[model samples]
Target chain A: MEDIIVRYISRIIVPFVQLYGLYVILHGHLSPGGGFSGGAIFAASMILYALSFNLSAGTKKLSHDVSSVLESGGALIFAGMGLLAVLLGTNFLGNRAAGFPLGIPGNLFSGGAIMVITFGVGIKVASTMITLFYSLIEGEGHSHD
Target chain B: MSAAAHLPALTVVVPLFFAYLMPLLARWRKSWCAATTLAVLAFTFFSSLYLANRVMSSGPFVYHMGGWAPPWGIEFYVDYLAVFTALTISGIGLPVIVYGIKDLPHELKEGVLGWYYTLYLLLMASMLGMALTNDLFNLFVFVEICAIASCAIISIKESRECVEAAFKYLVLSAVGSGCLLLAIALIYMVTGHLNFTFLAATLPGVMAVYPKNILAALALLMVGLGVKAALFPLHVWLPDAHSSAPSPSSAVLSGLVIKIYAVAMIKLLYKVFPATFAGMAPVMAMLLWMSTLAIIIGSMFAIVQEDIKKMLAYSSIAQIGYVFLGVGLASHNALLGGILHIFNHAMMKAMLFLAAGAFIYATGVRKLSQLKGIGVTMPVPAGAFAIGAMAMVGIPVTNGFWSKWYLALGALDAGKPLFAAVVLVSSLLNGIYYLPIIVNAFFSKPEGAVAKPGRLPAVMTGTLVVLGAGCIIFGIFPSLVLGLVSRATRLLLGL
Candidate 1:
């Protein structure tokens, strides 16, 4: 990882990779790309950063504690949304029946709880990937640094 | 809007919601995390009871997720069978959680307790979902969730052996999940429906046209669920994973988790497959032979094990054989016996594991040799273990006796006296392994310095007592569970 040229190139490219992931996550309902792929793409940016920099740098960027909290928080948000439907006197995870506003079709906010769920999933997946990578790498010595 | 209508969804969502909060609560207060977990499982237990009562009285109730109707949306179908299985799962889950409150701290590392509770709740929810879902795809999803959660909980022990066992379980179970998904895909390809009812309705026509495809689908589903259920040949992972897991996890894994897949398998055979197809297929006969081998061979393996947990783990494989044997016979009485075994085995096995855990917690002894006369020191757990052992041996007036009696009768009814003989021989085999442990625990004198029984937790001791009593109560009043099993079996047989 001491290759300066490779590091420089990754520094230039990582943000774009992350932006594309965001685009995919945001447009998940409108198109094929959604939470899983977008989250993976975002995770790839972090992984690339770790490779270019070092394991410690990656840990500094997204510590284990932060990632764990985010992972649980994403799941909680999804479950909480489902509970909202129940509290609203409908079945769990009910959308329109739960009184979530469905906006115009093909719009960003059109899918009611779908968009919210996708957002939660995206966060969850991205954090999970980073956490998994960090933990796996942590076992091996960061001798290169 | 009524709470009754919400029961189906709430049964699963309640556990999941609390599981999501577990880690955070653990961070705030460790005791709060355990309390919440117990509360969540208790809620699931009551909801399942209410749902089961409703199903029995009013017939099946289907709740479509997100207000969408079935054939297009995920549905929770609570029939006598589904609710019956759900009640067993949540009912067993509550006591195991109560036991875990005292037992887990000894097994898991300090910081991982929250994650353990979290995974435990998730496993319970997935099992409930597996029981309740009418959609094949949703069932597969729940199966994967249970598999992953179960593996994670096993690995939570942080021992090298625990991690290795968990990995083996993961790889094998992943293969099982893949096979299941492929089978569902094949079925969907032909029927163009994933909902069990819709598939059942259309399957006869499809089977008439493409018998081989249907058979292949059936075979794949059997092997897939067979691995998950720990049906003899595919059960290489069960002993290691169950024995190495933390005791409460082991109790759940051996007692309730494996049986849920068996329940799913029964649903597929009797409900999804057309009656004619089910009757004609040699799958049941094949299952009969495999289970016969499972019964004899699994018992033989159990007989030689020195480690008590490993012995019990092997015994589970054999007990699972009896359930499959019932399925294979496909007679009304045999099916009833099998269904009853599901509940009976859950109680006995959970009690046995918790008692084993208490022994470990009190004296740190896992080998049968070391257990010698330790019963004198810890009378309650030893007494519970003895009751569980008697039940395992199919002693009269124990719950296990009734199931075996009906299964033997079913074999006779099916004109298979040889299989009835097999059941009898297996009971003897069960006695050979189980009785010695109880006898040794109570009678044999300790060879070395006897470790004084440590202060066993009240909750842990109480769980064992309740389950031990359950073994006898259900044995005497088999009528309580038999009514449900008979109704479920009648439905399965389309009688």
Candidate 2:
């Protein structure tokens, strides 16, 4: 039954579901869903794929290397956003009036610090969730043939 | 315009960001790996020193995050105490990593070695983060990270006892974190602000308006931090956990982790809470009594222990009591003495743990009695250990003496000369247990021992020598670290 879900639903649903997750992340600054919520949703897409395929197959597709890089890149980008504020002669994490347009308050790119922080949270949640999934998989002694 | 204002946040970020980077670089060679960690720690250590110097020259450095300024965003405030903990964290952290480089091969296999370094860096980063963060909420987050990392590292050996110890640590820490979060949430309910300084600003209004809830939050916060600090009765898990972990981790956990929590408690007391509380003295007196008992009882426990590392682990509980006693007394000089002792103890304890690691590596013995004659063969490590023990026992010339001197003086200043007397007696007890190994190793020979020190590696001795030098330098020139402590203590006492 699990295999059937993997073969039938996941193969078809994974792509669209992940795209939706991305939408949740990008729209986080404008709406309710931000980095953590979107990242969790994105992870749900991959996790479903893993459930359908076996652990090794799932891991191979979403490898440790990818997760690590994503994690580091996400954090670096978060920090870079802060540095950008600093370079603009504002405070270290000052977002508004530091060059980037704050946009309208109710719009998509509305809140200054909120948007950048959302992206930071997005990267962190995505990579860390994946890492957690991998560790749990590895810890369960996932050495299937 | 000065760096002091932002120093607190940067102190946390540098190590923390390094922590996140380290695991990704895990596949690198051991030498390069150790070098990278050392470089990060050294960077952090210097930044702390620089910040401390700046704060001393200027005053408390306050950075309002996101430019929202205080009461809205978090306030990263660096006075003397925060800077002192920053220095202590990186100060001992670098040596532990240095000492770990030589001892790693023996404790861990090549495949999983990288994990050790990653977790070690995370532990360092978290401590630094916890030390410097001004947001009550952020402190909880960092404490969780430190807890998970330290728990993971403690069990790196895969031994049954290690697992059990780590498990105990995890459960207790979870409880502690829950209490801490609950308290912070309560504070938020009252003031709707998460920044400590902001909370302090509004606490009186909140308290005068609603006394019961504020007092309840205070109680919760104290209990939460008390468990983490391992205050006397709350310290059941510390000795076993410290003793069971591998050597370098044992050093970091004993010498740094609990002290940082104590610093946090000190911050909460003087910085956030109004000292004019009706029950302040009795509460402090309770802490004073508990810490005093912890010292004497901890030392007494140490005397009976045969396992060398276990003895030292118990000794740490006692030494921590001294710091607590000093701080709990509430006198300016007493607090200074306590804070200064945190630095002094880190150096001396790190030296002893590293030397123990060296001896463990060479002669393959851990019991103090079994280690009878290895000192004759391995003079450098033995000598290093002796110096550490002497410093720990409060010998007149060592750095440990200065902290003890200050503690004793502070105790006298607190008008409880008996506390000073207790410290003096405890120092003697410290000598009684710790001095024997040195004497036995050097002066009296044992029946069965290693023929000679079997190629004691340059790296091993190098770390030991550096720590030993720290003990001497800090001992003789107590003023060096005290300069940083006074600024911190001044803020804490509002003097």
Candidate 3:
């Protein structure tokens, strides 16, 4: 099935999918698609890239080391956000009580903890996807047999 | 920041963050993995102790995660009950790592060591998280993490049986996790809260409003956790996985992992289920009777096993039965004894596994029959095993004895002298299986008995000695542990 349609779709759809993934991530704080959903989209974008190309070629673009670091960094950032409250003379993860400006509840960038937790959930999701991809890529040709 | 809200988070995050940082750092230096694990464990131990102290002096400590503040947010209760569980996880866990350093590399294949530590730390973190979590959903999450990681660890050796056994463990445990998740969702739907304390407030109303939901959720939770905990009928996964896994993983799995799940069960019965649970008194009796069966059946099963590890694995079910029986009684002291056994068993049984591994390390022996002449050759490990054997049989001057004594006392307290007698009888049965190993080791002489050894490596030998010594120390120093346990039980029972 490696025909003209495959070439054309890969040419046009891949960039759009990738761009849409970026849009989801950036617009997470404002809309229904926050960190976890957006991060999943980001991972799916890479996976689509891999499926179009091969595993090694795709991983070359999305490195394992960088992904693991992102995973760890994401978790750390999430935890660090919580710990920041402790440093700020409030309790740990005291999002609203520590005053992150809970703007109009229905508006974008509202709900202080919602944003922080969203970001954290995003990082965790992104990292997990990356790690999974790495494992899949690294063990591409290996067989239990 | 009433101190209740953060203790659980600290217990979890200290180990979790460390576990996360560990392999990342181990990417640079391998020794640093072991060193970092110990340091993180030390930090967790101290934090748990501090939580225990607060629980003892102040009362149960409650912490809300993300400061969304429970019902809406995850909560951890660092009561004496939780602190005690956390302490057991760390206390037993630290020594396991110490033993694993030389011993595990010897037992497992290459390309798996880093993953081993990853799974180990994850195991420790999950147990810690499970023990401390007050939110049912959070507890379920930690339990799944523990189950997955533990199952992975079980098959780390790449043995054919290990693979099949781990697969069995995986499928059953995944089912159990699904049941637990379903239970959590059911509870949340009924109680409108995932936080345990909130559930405590709301459960009575929910139980009244939706009695069917109450039973369904509690039953599902029990089935899920019982499988995870390896209680009676649900315990089919334990023996194969425990025996087939590498020694260190076996030690952790048999020693403390199951009891942490039992503690979760305790939370369900006493805290969340309560009046509804008592209303289901028939179920409790069924649990008690089955635990009695577990004690009888597990000890008998242990006697027949030729593989040294298999014998110890069966012994674990029996030892766990004592905890289940005590908790099953659900009386104050009975529950205390069950809770107390968690720490006691963790120390004593893991000591047995480590000592067993030492033999496996030096002589490459796996079966009990093969070890007839082993005592003559490997005196220290054999001696350590003998001490562990005696401890397992609940001999006085070992920690096992005290927990069994408490359990017996608890049975008597519950006006069930027959069950107390059973507890006593199980000890004898424990002796029946374990004593032969000692006698055969120290006395019997098989062919080609070569007594050439200083000791297993210090990491290995030292861990066994310390744990064997701990079995004695904790036994002798009963008041220290009992005080913490009684306070912990008081917290659990809300006295």
List the global CA lDDT of all models. Answer: 0.90, 0.81, 0.80
Docking class of 3: acceptable
Q: List candidate 3 segments past 4 Å from native.
A: A1-4, A98-117, A137-140, B1-7, B276-280, B446-455
Could you tell me how far off, in angstroms, the CA of residue B436 lies in candidate 3 after the best superposition?
A: 0.5
Higher-DockQ candidate among 1 and 3? Answer: 1
Q: What is the DockQ of each candidate?
A: 0.77, 0.47, 0.42
Q: Compute each candidate's TM-score over C-alphas.
A: 0.98, 0.93, 0.93
Ranking under lDDT, best-scoring first? 1, 2, 3
Question: B119-223 in candidate 2: lDDT tens per residue?
Answer: 888888888877777888878888889888989888887788889999998899889889999998888898988887777788888887877777788778877
Candidate closer to the true structure by DockQ (higher is better), 2 or 3: 2
For candidate 3, lDDT tens digit of each residue in B216-239? 887787789889888888889899
**Residue clash pairs of candidate 1:** none
Off by over 4 Å in 2: A1-7, A10-13, A109-117, A142-145, B1-8, B28-31, B278-281, B446-449
Q: After superposition, how far is residue B23 of candidate 2 from its true place, in Å?
A: 2.4
lDDT of 2 at B24: 65
RMSD of each: 1.6, 2.5, 2.5
Candidate that would win on DockQ: 1
Predicted complex 1: CAPRI docking category: medium
TM-score, chain B, predicted structure 3:
0.96
Tell me how far the alpha carbon of residue B455 in candidate 2 is from the true structure, in angstroms, after superposition.
2.1
